[model samples]
Target: MRLLLLPLLFSLFCGSLTAAESVRLTNGEWPPYLGEQLPHKGVASRIVAEAFALQGVEVTWEFHPWARSLQLAERGKRDGSAVWLHSSEREEKFFISDPVVESGYYLFHRKGYSFDWQQIGDLQGRRLVGTRGYDYGAAFQQAEASGQLRVNRVTSDETAFRQLIAGRVDLFPMDKVVGFDMLHQHFSAAERAQLSFHPKPLRSDSLHLLLSREVPGNAELIARFNQGLAQLRESGKVTQYLLEIQQPLSLAP
Candidate 1:
């Protein structure tokens, strides 16, 4: 009886240990998506947290610079990154979750600038503002590579917009919602009035949570996260979370 009881107690302890397992993810200060000050750490962070909660796992986030965030995840310093764009290079080292949100890229120019483009070819000879370390898309990247488009690279989106307002660049491309968030935060009403997003969006892509393959148990973690995300979508929680930020679920499409 003592032997049997000892085995049962050990099993219970192991089960509790499993139940208390948690994951730590690195995140960058991307507002309206993921931020330290925003409610529940912003929409995307809330979604990721709740989804993992549903899987009986807890998650904690540490803020870092975007490049460092990816590096930490990739090197197994953290279990994963809270969110990032899926790329072939990233895919090589990480297990990417189902997309948490879709992002659209649009060209923003100063109002009255009369700039418009229907295709990449139309961008020839144009001065495009690009953020350092950001990937716009294959077409835009290829165009920049071939010298079809000249880009003035800046360190951040805010800097890019400042350059645009200063007439330093012809146009800039950014996520519509993210660009608006920046406008709300940094630009005066007068400055806001001077800017507009082009009617033609450059492209759209989905953002995903990337679990580093180098991290132990990451495969199971990714599977659990994906399952929870699907459940959140079905239950309309994802939509509810977006509405809290006054952003429409439709924006993600």
Candidate 2:
């Protein structure tokens, strides 16, 4: 009986080693994506938590300012940060997991203001409202660099949208789903109805979970996360999770 018990205990210990205890990830108040007050802390949060659970791991989240969250994760104070866009600079600093959310940039303008642009060049002379710490893609960045466009950098999406409605900016660029969520939640029906999203998207991007390279076993952790994410996708939990967010539009990739 003792010998049999010893083998069982050893197997359990090995299993524990394979299944890490938990991961602490930092995030910010990205509503409908990640927010403390949101149901299950929002869709991306739900997906990440479920994915890790599939691998017998638990996730703990801490909310901070977006910049600080990234700072903490980059310094290895946290295991990782979630729902960040892919950039070459960031790719060097952290190991990004499989795509967790699909996102794209759209030009949001007042309903009374109709404009058409075939390329970034066509945005010349436009007064734009943009959020701080956002990458609006290379084309927009280059155009901004060359003085082709004017942008008023604000602290939050809410501020940007307000500026747009007040005629402070000709166009505001942001993630379509996120921006619309903000508009729907914060503005009146009339105010929301006054907004229009350009038919042509400015850019398409996906958000991913970023693991700190400085952390030990980071590679293995990402591998486990990817496997779990794939499993979630296969089981259709991923789709259901998105649906639970109550997004106004389908998020199909």
Candidate 3:
């Protein structure tokens, strides 16, 4: 009886240790999906936190500018960063997780600007505004790098939208819902009416968490996150969370 009890006691101790395990991650404001003030810091953050919780790991978040968030994660000051598009350069520096969220990107422009595109080539000579530290998609990236299209980079999404409204750029591509949220938050009702997005999606992209390679044991950490994410998906909670944020919008004037 004493020998059997000893193994049970050790198992309980190890289980408690795993239950207490926690990690801090960096994140940025991209409301309805991710924001400091939003509940559970928005859906993406909530999903990440809950998924880790499923694996008995607690998560804390540090909010910063998107670029700064990436830097902190890259330097291993934090465990990882939530929600970023994939790029070849990032793949080398971090262990990318499974798709954390579905991100539909669309082209936003002023109401007066006539924008149309059938392919990447359609953007030729158009003054496109791109936000830095974001990967629009593979085709757009390839076109921009080869000078087949003209893309002027901005430091933030707000700046890109502002430039578009001022007619400084021919078009601005952004996450469809994120773009709408930004416009509603920063611009007046009239201003919101003056902006519109093309119905065609630029990319139906998947956002992923990036855990830095500089941190020891992060490979295992990423694996755990992916496994937890798979559980979330299998349980149908992921779709339920997404449905809550997709309130019907009257975007057109």
Candidate 4:
């Protein structure tokens, strides 16, 4: 009887351990993707969460600075992160899930500015501002390296927007969806009246979930997430959820 009881206890302990070792997600503030206001309400966040949930896996979310969160994911200190733009550089360090969102980079400026640049060379003498640690794709990187584009890095998107408004910077590059969201949330009606977003997209990329190399069974987790997302899309639940959380201002034409 004693030996039988020990085996039962050990089996229970292993089951608990397996449950605890399931999916755990790390993320940071990235509006319309993952952020504080809506908590885990962002499109990418919900998709990833629901995907894992469908697999009978429980997920826990922890927020940190974006860079720090990525570091956590990279080191396997956390299981994964949502809403990361897929990149080769990142691919080298992490396994990326199927695209959960698509966003385009755009040029934002004060309403009165009349800047037009079809190519990097067109901005040879102009100063551009962008969020710290953000990649504007290869063109901008080459321009920066050749000293053709003067770049200013700010700590946050808000700061870049503010500097543009204050005429402290010539141009700022940001994700069109996120930029519009921020503009609606942070700018007063009067302030918004003085700003404009260009129709031209600098670059478009799909956002994905990034898993650390050390997270055991990440391939299985990613496959499950993809399956879940496909189901959500087929059922129209993804669109419905996005509509439910979508801000009125974000729907503006």
User: Clashes in each model (backbone N, CA, C under 3 Å)?
Assistant: 0, 0, 0, 0
lDDT of 4 by residue, 42-123 (tens): 6668877887776667778888888888888999888888778888899887888877778789888877787887887887
lDDT of each: 0.87, 0.87, 0.88, 0.79
RMSD of 4: 3.8
> Which has the higher TM-score value, candidate number 3 or candidate number 4?
4
Candidate number that wins on lDDT, 2 or 3: 3
Please identify which of the two predictions, 2 or 3, would achieve the higher TM-score against the true structure.
2
Q: What is the C-alpha lDDT profile of model 2 across 1-253, one tens digit per residue?
A: 9988999999999998877789999988877889988888889998999999998889999999889999999989999999898888998889999999888789988877869999998888888888887889989988887888888889888999989888878999988778867777878777777788788999998889999998998889999999999999999988887776655643221
C-alpha lDDT of residue 209 in model 2: 96
Best by lDDT: 3
Per-residue alpha-carbon lDDT of model 3 for 1-253, expressed as tens digits? 9999999999999998877889889999889899999999999999999999998889999999888999999999898999988878999989999999999989888887877887989889888999887888889999989989789998989999888888888789898878777777777777777788888999997899999999999999999999999999999999999887776444553
Better of 1 and 4 by lDDT: 1
Off by over 4 Å in 4: 1-21, 37-41, 243-247, 250-253
TM-score of each: 0.87, 0.86, 0.80, 0.84
- The global Cα lDDT (0 to 1) of model 4 is 0.79
Off by over 4 Å in 1: 1-19, 246-253
lDDT of 4 at 91: 88
In model 1, residue pairs whose N, Cα or C atoms come closer than 3 Å (at least 3 residues apart or on different chains), thus clashing, are none
